[model samples]
Target: MENKKRIPNWLKIIALLIFIIGGYFGWTAYTTFLASNVTDNQKYLYINTGDTYLQVLQKIKDQKIVEDPNSFDRAAKYQNYTESVKPGRYALTPGMNNRRFIGNLRGGYQDAVKFRFENIRLKENFAGKLAENFEADSITFLKLLNDENLAKSYGFTKDNFIAMFIPNTYELYWNTAPEKLFARFHDEWKKFWTKDRLAKAKAINLTPQEVSSLAAIVKGEALHKDEMPAIAGLYLNRLQKGMLLQADPTVIFATQDFTIRRVLNKHLRTDNPYNTYIYKGLPPGPIMMPSIVAIDAVLNYKHHDYIYMCAKEDFSGYHAFATNVAEHQINARKFQKALDERNIKK
Candidate 1:
């Protein structure tokens, strides 16, 4: 009776084969196609705190960025990265696989771009150039340059104006808003001055802002980097003694033009507070972004009773300083002689 009821061994084998094949196909569909990094090309993934793996998966699917989340999950589980995702803004692209797309999102790669404001003086020049390059509407950039409201928002006093702006290289994304661009630079400036550097400035009775102003003066005085510290000392001595800084760079800042061959009498009387030749006490704010050399010079300036300085004839990146008017006159004459010999019209 048991032998008569026994099923054929071949039929059992065929049924088992069908079951194995079907299981294999179902597993592939669940892991490879249905579970994976599903990101919508058009949707933005905002990853802040408290986001879970399932929430992330749902977002990927809802945005239509991925055709299947099940495939992504299966792959992620296999790699043991199912719960190791990072939190930040993530950008997803089309046709991305589960592991590749999930990995980037978990890594938090933000979009960015490169830009520079180094050696730039005029506001409109920087604004127009950057705006045009970023397709941000040139007119809008120029308006920001001239915008008093924006100026005031960034700790600018009524008198500070554009002088508070620090010039340097920068990187930003194409979608970066105008306000963000301004704030980013400001933040960078704050971090640029280290704790030790800040202490050094404080020891010299100069705030970070004051140090920057002094650095700007050093920048205008020295044609060569080697001359910076010495020139910086001369100005510091003058400032300590209540003497006029009388820096030529101040005149350039006041005029908003750097082409002045000489510091004319009229330049001293300009309306801008940046004119150190006329106004006193650090010109109300920084005149320009100073290099590290300038800042160091101010912090470690050579102390001297001498209140006057002029360009040395040697142009060896050093200046010949003087203690009195007679000595100053001699030094000035020597510089003038060299200038004349070289046919420099100053």
Candidate 2:
């Protein structure tokens, strides 16, 4: 038999060394790219608009979202996430590998925020809320809301623009731009005004905006949902007779002192156009964001001859309706006496 050339000891040692080194590097790569790197607890990562990759990394580090920062950095660089940062609100789940995390950041795989707003009293307040949830700042949202040309494009005046935002919960991406957000609201408003709703508006001789404004008044006055239709009807009667709405809520809004529990003569004397006691028609716009129930109440208001309303004396959040001054005065007196008893001076 031909003797096989014995492998050289030096060569065998070199080959073994190479195999060991390769295995070590392979294990390192596996840990860096495939092993769980995220913290055990779930967390949310908010990357604001115009954020650089370094800022995003710092946010991750500060939040302690990753179990091994070095591994995450290595995976991020390998996946080219450093150059492909996207603005968003992202969810970091437990047991997420660095590769998956970097991939989500690179691909803009973000979570939607459950955004909800109601009873917002001012555009600034709305803006602040938007800023609190979105990547855009409050000033950015305010600028969009105050842009006359932008409002006109959406068939809304700056004063009535808030009416477009129906009070409800929405699924919105946190990176939504101000213009896109306004467009989304306008889309929702259009969706709300179906053919049936449009016909109802026409029957009442009120535009959708007018309905929203009246609904806001109805919302402010009636705390009980069952009483909304009656209150809405009362206001409709006043509107038909060209009577001053004379709504105390309007005076409260005009005074901009939301703490006023009682609308005194001084409050009614506020000179702003929102003071329905001073202005003839529905104030320039809604005093507050109205609920869907309130808006529907205006659309389906009860037909009645009553032209006046007074909050009930028992503080039951119900109202007393009246057709004439004498009846209204009786109801008003009862309520005034209740207020005096409670020592509600404002």
Candidate 3:
């Protein structure tokens, strides 16, 4: 009994206090780590290429996503996430804690960015759009695209490199390199030109690039999708006859004046290789980015004897086809008269 009394009340109180303090600290740490520490308003975090740990923490703080950045920092350090910074778009939701957030960064569970483009007209515009959507800048992308040797290695010229990109949506990492982007396009191009497509191209006696070029011309000449096949056929007829394409769209391209409502005799004499009237063949490159519909239209061109076409006098976006020069001239005269009446002199 005396030995039992040797265990004093003050020592017992000290042991109880120690246990309570340890439990409180442990509960606080568990809440900070395992429990939700993210604000309800927080949704996502964007980690750019080559971001350091501090930058990531600052971005989290700036976005007001994390309630305790210090706790997150400690977790990240413990998980060795501070050294491995993954660059990408990350998905976050409300009520996420330091454990989950750090685990995502450490495991590199980033969201894939959706990439897409359409109706692009100019190379610069294409480059700018790509830059806006990707990590690469416009100048760097343009330079790589225009590298003649690099393009030749891919069996394309700088002029026809635009053909490699088929207009569609793609999923890729936000921090994809410029070279990787080019390779992805190349792969997509290969996938697009399947055996059946290759056979169709062979039957038409045109390379894929040539088909895309003609498709661009066809797309430029017609605003209505239904007219593409017939316009493609008309141009094919002219090509077969060894005659000038004489496509007004090519003249507009040569003049670089998209605002011209009418192609006059003066515009046709621009003397550029893109001027189909003077070149007597396909242009060296596409006049604009062609749609997949336009490309398929060229491949499945309607068999027709028509060699001429003119925009109809009606303001509706349609065209009139002619099998002979006389009919074509009449159609042209009618269109010119309509233009004159509308005071569209340019």
Candidate 4:
């Protein structure tokens, strides 16, 4: 009987202590963490070139953006976001707890579709690749290029369509609209042909299309930036004298190879319009996606009266410009000697 009575008093004391402890914890939790309410306001967070987690936290706090970076980071750590932040723009929002925020930062978010072009060869190939990545009708894109009756929707010509695609990296939404994609390429092409570029082309009496063509030629010849102006000058001189450009890249574009053994009679027979060796002035359109540097080289080609040039044997990415056929022959012999020494099959 005495033991049972003693047990009740001790149980009462333990219950009272438990109630006091629970109250303390509840009060602190309410004051510290639960005081602020999470709203649905939009916010933005930036990750700079080289930033650490602590630095990012400080930035977040200093900007008065997120009130509790520790909790955010703690949740990030729980979700293993030690290095989840990517370098670019992101649209953020409030009411996103640390877990959801970190999850998104770690690429648990909507992915932006990607388009890339490095060294693609033809328009058909381009259409096919676009079809593969972007869910656009590849057959339709091909039909558009081929002038088939199935799809006559595209506004640009086959040649103009190829010219419009800027060869570079692009980020777009997943499953893009066809009209928007077409409009984007055309818009980008027009923007690239800015007012400054037009004025320069006007000075030379070259049309926008002609300048675009010249830019492509300049790109093909000068494999190195240092030789751009020199290569441009040689072609400009050829154009002025009404002489054939005789550029090997044009032939290579036709033959689709660097191997010709020589610029033989047969290689010239391949009838691709890019063959400047057989045909006149410039190719019908831009052969490759011209770089800004190549465009500038054509615009500001040296005023020198150089008429011929051959590759420098040193492969210093510079060429030996010649004023006449004799000097060009000498340089040409030197290049041939180097080729022979290396047993270059081309």
Q: Highest TM-score among the candidates is held by which one?
A: 2
**What is the TM-score (0 to 1) of candidate 3?**
0.91
Off by over 4 Å in 1: 1-111, 145-153, 158-169, 264-272, 315-317
**Residue 344 error for model 2, in Å?**
1.1
Runs in model 3 deviating more than 4 A are: 1-16, 39-44
lDDT of 1: 0.70
Q: Alpha carbon lDDT of residue 6, candidate 3?
A: 73
- Of the candidates numbered 3 and 4, which has the greater lDDT value? 3
Could you give candidate 3's per-residue lDDT for residues 192-288 as a string of tens digits? 8888888888897899999999999999988999989999999989888899999888899999999998888999889999999899889998888
- By TM-score, is 2 or 4 better? 2
* lDDT (Cα) of model 4: 0.69
Estimate, for each residue in 87-166, the C-alpha lDDT of model 1 and write its tens digit.
55455565566666656755656444557555544566667767754546667776776677877776554334444455
TM-score of candidate 1 to 2 decimals: 0.61
Name the better of 2 and 3 by TM-score.
Answer: 2
lDDT sort, best first? 2, 3, 1, 4
Cα-based lDDT for every prediction: 0.70, 0.91, 0.87, 0.69
Indicate the residue-level lDDT of 242 in model 3: 92
Ten residues in a row with the worst lDDT in model 2? 40-49
Models sorted by TM-score, best on top: 2, 3, 4, 1
Clashes of 3: 0
